[model samples]
Target chain A: MINSIDLILVLILLAVLLSLGSSRMMALIKIMALQGAMVSLVPIFIEPQARLSNGGILFFQLMLLIKAVLIPGLLYMALNRIAIKREVEPLIGYHASLLVGLGLVMLSAYITRRMGLSLPGDYALLLITAITTTGGGLFLMMSRTKAITQVIGYLMLENGIYLVGTALTKHTHNIYLVEFGVLLDLLAGVMIMGIILHNINRAFDDVDTAYLEQLKD
Target chain B: MLEAVFCLPLFAGLIAFLLPVKLGRGVLVVGALLHLQLTLLAWLSDFPPLLPGYFSTAPAGILVLLVTSFIFVFIAPYSIFYMREQEMQSEPIFIGSMLLFLGTMSMAALAEHPIVFWIAIEATTLVSAPLIFVNRSKKALEATWKYVLICSVGIALALLGFFFITLSMDRAGIDVPLTFSSLNTAAKHLDPLWLKIGFIFVIIGFGTKMGLAPMHTWLPDAHSEAPSPASALLSGALLNCAFLGIFKVHTLMVLAGLGDFSGSLLIGFGLFSILVAGIFILKQPDYKRMLAYSSIENMGVIAFGVGIGGMALYGAMLHLIHHSLLKSSLFLSAGNLLLGFGSKIVAQCGGMTRLLPRTFVSFFAGFLGISGLPPFGVFVSELLILIGAFKAGHPVAGGLFIASLALVVAGFARIVTSMSFGPSRQEILVPEQTLRIVSPFALLLTSAVLCVWMPEPLHQIIINTIAVIGGTIHG
Candidate 1:
């Protein structure tokens, strides 16, 4: 039987795939929230020793709140205000993006296998999931035309990095304060991006970033 | 003392946000003066870090701190005049963000720990985003969006790199602190594979912020679209902070005996940046964008110098100082031109020598200084870098460096000469002001003076900074 950790990792990978295939902004935001919650859970499950500390528990709770609730809530609010229900005229088609997402997962798996890193059991899977999530986020950012989608992409990227941090770092080395700072930065980043998205909508009458081509060389 | 260096700005920024526009501008100037004074005091005498583990002033840190502080003291007053001419609706926010941006950059400069540095660098992006969008124009909005998204993504990767570094320590069973100094001392015992991987990520991440080639798409747009004073800070003070991040990691790579691996990457990115900038500079239409590309080229030079090691590293340090001075001056002068002609298109800015003689002198002088002309510190720095490149036995790289420099100079000459002598366009929108012109002039003068004479303390600091990478003045 697959362990709970492996199950959660697979669920997170599914979230990445769903985000890539989904065209609706609301769906993407929901997928990110789910992914964020899963990413926060990884630390607690992977490092049982970390759960012993009250500070770690409090830090994880804070991370969960921000990553899962605060950031996605901000993006959701942006989506409502902008009223752009879907990412229109994406630079790439959805079918092609889904195919690219599949290729990314396979490539990440190949990399993990070729590196021969002696990670603990199932960590190679964890690494593969994190890499795919990160790559998918970047692809989303590059492929989608809407500014809101790019913000979601950035949040996805941060979530992946958070996973990498959890998978690689030791429990004892994880300082709650530094992690808190990182989370705060991420929250603030998403909020700021949301504000800009609102302004872009106001200025251009839509959230699409194709209008931004005016500044090119 | 270190707390005061950043705290004064933070406190002033809050007040500036609440106050009236005129008072807010006053607070900004006062805060800049106080910040610069604190920076000088910190430089002259060492004090224990207020927060011992998180913050301290290393030689490299102080070098960047000095540049940031010095440039701000000029930019602050110029901004008052600049905002007044524009009559910005969000003057308060602009002033507040400027101060906050200064505070965050100071924090980055003084940060000793990798995570602290990461947070501080990321903070610079958040704080400066408002300054870019303060204009509320469509182009400003685009620039701000791209700036925030690209930089935040880049810095996120840097966080992963930091994790890998921690992983290296875990694998090696080394229990040292995560400070750069400590890490450097323990680097030899760390896992080399993980360390190399970490270095690559850090370089690419911070290199994106540093405007190195292939990752520099955001630089031209953000710099050209932001208000001139904000562009000056972004180009001058902010890029140096990103370089400090890379330089710190490179120090660790050197200590880990992987200097060759990291050095070649820097050299490769640096040369490509120069080539790219050279190619784009040749036919650039917008004057501000041209200067922005020039900033990219100078950054390339600094990176190349550092990567060459030995004497070139010393040259890189000097290039860092001179580039900050000259490029900020150029941006500020470009601001005056923008104000005078009410356009950023180079074609519309002809006969600048006659139209705005005061700005022309500073603008033309700034061009000469940036293009590595004599009587300027950049001349000395570029000469030193070239000599270092040859001394390091990279003759092909040296040749390419020279060729790129020639192309840049040729392109810059054509533009500056045309802007100076070509037929005039529309009438001046806002005539040049003494207050606006003073900042750029002072910066150019500083570069010229430093070229002729090097102060002992500053010279010693440069030596100490480069010594870690095996750099010396005597090639």
Candidate 2:
């Protein structure tokens, strides 16, 4: 089950995420699409064993389709609507974010190793991918300045959490519903927040949080 | 009927949405009264006992729900005058949202399921978001933004903490359900490592909602920017709802064999919040924000007491009750001052004692009660917390607690003396001519009575109830 295709998929995901944490907002969306592609393969890699029930396979495919493809498509539409161009300024510089993302990836691996998340004792790369994606998403959140960018960061974080649950298929079933609910909620959250971002830009002429100080005492 | 306590508010919220504006504000009071009535019924029943997981009301939440419901009852009428004075036409939306906000808070308190509790907590963030935006001011929008972003991020981390709690139970080979009963029953089997991580995340998440230090940046702005009645609910009841989450999780942490891990973290965050509030309040120029920061400090004291554990949890719960009354009164009075003097900055307006004697007196009383002066509820709560800290061998925290309280007291003293008792700036002062001016007086009186004497029967029940929840893990 340790397929070369799966390894290549994860490597591409990593390369894309490395781009997401950079100042290039357009590049961030491309990386998101690549990460999206890798997430769709997670179910196949986890259990190509016909040892699964029909219902399980159906749900798996549904998750892959909805999460990896449909959600990204919706976000792409939003990107076109808002037209926020590349991030003009970020709270933390993009280069520093890349370094921090690297450190978080390392931390995720360490934490996973401690928790024994590597299933089949052979899929060490799965553990690495889970941590890297989650860390990268968080890095996007911390470094990004644009409000839309923050929303995108949150979406990537959801992708990371999805991988965590997917890797743990051997342990539970109830978690699948929770993961779906989380994704739905996250996607809805991004869409609503995107609208709010548009309003902020329209009202203030800039979506940067720098001018959000109108409420202070 | 027990579940009805939460559902009734939801129903009221929906009905309010369909009503006329003038009728809507009036309907909000009706909803709040009904909510209080339902809370009393639940308090009298056995059906809604803490769920079968870790810790719930047989220990800590009964008192929380009762006190919160009781204060909401008083604040409901106060809100009527608040709305009427503003000539609010969109009352239905505000009232409906407020009902949902309170309903979700009760759900969080009475939740048997951990996931249910998280959902309820998240619901509060959504429902309260609209309430903060009730004024639709630029400032309101800004504050609402901070409130939503910070609290949502905080609650998300809390959810992650829930994930860790489940992960820990998995490690221990016990099928510990997320219910209070199940968690407590299986607590001994929980993995310590995962519990530590879970407790930290839960603390920070709920702590942000509670306005605990470092994560408390949203409290002052949101509290000061919202309408007074909303601020009353926020400072009085909402923070307690968040604290209930932390308290419940800590109960499980104790049973997980990582004794004091959660408690120490609470104490650390609590003490830091108090110190931060004290430092900032000493130089604060805005009185409303100062009061907001004072709230952060009081929440810190409660956290410290809860972290101390054992007897300290009881003290923490007691302080939770007293502080709610004191703070809501203070905020309501701030509203009166705002109405009378039309300014929030301390330097811009004053001579309140000469301008409006009744409001000035009530404001000072609230300030005194919050400062832990004798004969008030805060004084008694503080004493209990200090005793609990010493009992838990946290004498250093106890010492720092006294120093921080003194610093806060001094800062508040200067503000009260300067704002209420002395010179007025050039701002125009209007004469009080309506019932709205008198409503704050009434709220402060209820709080004053609670401080002076929390009826014996209620106190006995609440104290016993808290002990049961707090002791569930240890037993």
Candidate 3:
């Protein structure tokens, strides 16, 4: 029986593919926002045993706001600030990257079955989506030249890792506090990256990482 | 309380961000002094955790905490003088970020819970990013970007690794609280397959931050581009915090009877880092970048020492202490040279023996100390690790280790010699100041003193730290 949890995981996998194939920076950020909102909802649906205490509900709301709204909003502001509306010239082409994204799903499924952990219900789907999202995010980082897009890549990577954490660990531990800390770190990391991105734009007149090659040995 | 060690710096840092520039400088120094005092107090007596699940002091962590605090005490004062000479545009931010970086590192040292440790480690990366970009040059911007992006990605993998460990625990049907101490106690019961997988991720993740090669691409750029005082802290102190993360997980692997697998992996990465550092150091154009590569090499040596276990693990602990002291001192000396000549390129500025004699003395002494010569703690530690490698039946790795060390020394000597004595007569920009000169000398002296005679308590602490992994001082 397919449930809402499995549905959310599949949507996440689709978001990963869209992010990889999308050429415009603004569209990539939007995909990340949608992926973030969906990934944060997985924990609530997957664990039927975890009755939503007051704290848990509050935690989920905060996670939703930060992951869905606050982070993408910051990226949106950063994009406007840079005023670079041109298409990204990826090292790998959009079609090729989309193919790679599809490949990642197949590879992740192979790995999930090979591990043979016997996860209950559709949790295996959660694992596959998690791995594919992570791999796709990494691939995005390598293929893109612009720094802002790379940061978007990082956000995807982070969301994927969050899914992995939710899938593997039991919620019996008072994990809210720890998870909250991780979220805070992610928010701060994005802010810091935004500031640096602004500076990079100011200095080089573009966020192309190729301009950053001056310091290498 | 244990919490105060970190809390004091976090608050002081926030205050420093708002205070006047002069006042911020004072807070930087005063904050370091107070932090050292609290760390000493924590060392002398037990401070039970305010939050038992998140924060606690273990022997190894306290050792790292002490080293971090001791180095900051000197670097903070040195930064005031260094920044004044540079006429920094963002003095308050630099000062504030330094303090915050200290606080985050202290928190990482004290973190008992796995997630708390990850948060602290990740926070360190975020806070320290500003330190590298304080100069605001194009190169500095590039360095800061790479440092943030690479370390963040690497550390995120570490979070995944922690999840795997927790998964292992769930599979074993054990329900212990998620702390390193608790994990160590229940380690023998963990499924070896998951445990092994987790160890690989943790090492690679933390290893990236610790400046192991392949992942060490960011270290040289960031270190050389930062203001020298910030570079000193990044090289001397920050790397150790990352190493502590790997060390904790390695202890668990050993307890779970998977030492051989983890140890071999460590040895491989360690030797590779040394080889990589040696190749880059030989033709290195920038003096600061050369020092940064040397840092990578020393970190490799420490990793190799710990991986060989037995006496080598004991040597690794000693190496950790001396490397922080000696490498930081070297960076401070490099800072003085930068101020004197206003250039990072070695060929552009020369005759340091004539133009900047005081800096030449400390710089030359630092070169000797770091090269593992006599009267320096690194010498003793490296020797012990070498002997242990042979005794532990890793003679081939031992031979590769010595070859890499020789290559590193040869490259290092060429660079240092040219800088100190190579023929050039450029006018010095800023003459050596007493305040600028004292800290490096003091740090080098501490390393030298420890080499000859370690205090009894420090020796005992080193013994306690290594013993958890079956390391003994006497082979």
Candidate 4:
């Protein structure tokens, strides 16, 4: 019997799927936000003892607060400012992307189960988070037309990995430092990328990657 | 002072940033010199006291720090020339960012812990993005975008790999310290499943940064699009930083009794990288992009050689040095040509030799050096790798290596023939302040000369570092 709270994980999985299949760039960014929130909750659902580390509940919630809520919102605002409104027709199309994402998820499950793997904790939520992150990142790269979307996909991928980290590993100083570094770098990256993308759109009059083939042989 | 080498650059980056723009370049040069001296000092003396925090280095990072510092030294005069006539206020910021890139790489090499190394790797990606867009052009932005996207994904995966290593160590009841030495000692007892999982992520992660095939989509674009100084450092030094991380992981795998599995996987990617370069080079239309493809190929060769242990790992180490020297020179000369004649496309350009004599000579010298002409550093290193390949009883692999290399040579020859040999198509003036582009070319000549001249001091440095790396992994 599936517990009611597990619905959040299922819905996150659904959001990951929708992000993979969506053509609307704006909609995909929103889906990314939902995915982030879902992944952040993974720690509580998966890591038990960690649930009590110095108001650990709030601390664990911070991962979602930053990763899920903050990042995607930042991305959406970037997209809005850039005014790059269009359906993302990936070099590879949506139907094929859906097929690949589905295949990868199934493969992850099959591979993990067959490996006879078991962690110290419940890890079921953590496992699902990892697979979702990997699959979503792959999908984002293949499914998005804009460079911004691809970066957002990469962020989603990192968030998924962080979910695994916080959920499974002991809360060490080094881990926290790694987490902070990752977030700061990713944020700085987005800011730098936003400036560049704005410049690209202004210069080329079209941020479509087709125009980028000038340097290629 | 291993710790000092790391600490100084970080301080220097901030120092360089705080200095005036005109002084910014000089400050960078001083910081590099100080950093290099300290690294040399560390190598000569006993291990530097490990600062009780997250960062440190071993015998390995001393060599990494030295090589990167030398590259900075080489680029200094060149950057002085490279940045001339560049716009107003952004100059300081740009130079500051480049210093930060070096500082981050320094921390990475000097780090004792896995996470510090990962942060450094990711930070290099962020710092380098602006360098890609130095010209503020549409094309530069696209290249920068691709670079940011691909490498970000790759490094993120690597960070995940770091987490996996931590998890594996935890499973082994090893107290989960996450230091290189600690992990190395416990690696043999780690759960094979977790170790394998960690390795897959590391390979994919670092492999992207190393410009390995499949993950190499960003390399050629970023290389061709960035200014020459950035391209030279990108190919010469930056890729090496990523390769060092991968090398450390490979060493850990060797200790874990997973040497064969990891080696086999590396060889697979290495060969694929060469094949991709071969195909790309054959049809390549842009001369700069062609050089970029060649970098991918040379890196592929190193990866393949490293994967096939025995004499091969030593060969890969040697190849890494040679590739850095020759590739930097090649890209620098390419930069000279682009400035002299305003085009990277092979078909549009002609008679470059008559118009730009010194640039032509530099280009030819770089070409000869990179194409493995006898007496050039690349020739010696590549020949060693070929011999290593044959000794490993992989004649098929050897043959493939030879063929791929030949394909690059012939393709590049066609590019050079059209671009540098014919009659003067027009009067080509060198860019206003590009006189110092010759520095990288001069450095290349020096490196090539060392390969033949084999001075005792230099020989000691190269041979000892190779042995240090090889001794750890060779069964």
Per-prediction DockQ, in order? 0.83, 0.32, 0.91, 0.55
DockQ of 3: 0.91
Q: Model 2: what is its DockQ?
A: 0.32
lDDT by residue (B1-475, candidate 2, tens digit) is 3667777787888888898876777777888888887777766656543323422445356677887787787777777777766766567888888888888788777776776677778778777777777776667766877787777777777876777777777667676445766887788877788788788888888888989989999999999888888898899999998988888787777766665677788899999999999998998888888989999999999888877876767667668888888888888888778877788888876788778677788789889888988666777778878887787687899999999999999999999999976786555455554465455566566666776777875777656755644531121
Clashing pairs in 4: B56-B110, B56-B112
Candidate 1 lDDT, B135-237, residue by residue in tens = 8898989999989988888888888888889899988989987888899899899999999899889988998899998889999999998999999999999
Tens digits of lDDT, candidate 3, B1-475: 6899999999999999999999999999999999999998888777887998899878898999999999999999999999989999999999999999999999999999998999999999999999999989999999999999999999999988998898899889899999999999999999889888898889989999999988998999999999999999999999999999999999999999999998998999999999999999999989999999999999999899989999999989999999999999999999999999999999988999999998999999999999999899999999999999999999999999999999999999999999888987658899999999999999999999999999987898889899999999998
The digit string of per-residue lDDT tens for model 3 on A55-170 reads: 78889999999999999999998999886754567899999999999999999999999988768555899999999999988998999999999999999999988888777777
Candidate 4: regions farther than 4 A off: A1-8, A18-31, A44-65, A86-108, A166-174, A204-207, B1-20, B47-53, B85-89, B431-438, B453-475
Comparing to the true complex, what docking class would candidate 4 get? medium
Model 3: CA > 4 A from native: A49-51
> Which has the better DockQ: candidate 1, or candidate 2?
1
Best by TM-score: 3
For model 2, the stretches where C-alpha displacement exceeds 4 angstroms are: A1-12, A15-83, A92-96, A99-103, A114-123, A162-188, A214-217, B48-59, B87-90, B425-434, B437-439, B468-475
TM-score versus the correct structure, for each prediction: 0.98, 0.88, 0.99, 0.89
Sorted by TM-score (best first), the order is: 3, 1, 4, 2
Score candidate 4 by TM-score against the native.
0.89
Clash totals, every prediction: 0, 12, 0, 2
Cα deviation of B294 in candidate 1 (Å)? 0.4
Q: Cα deviation of A24 in candidate 2 (Å)?
A: 6.2
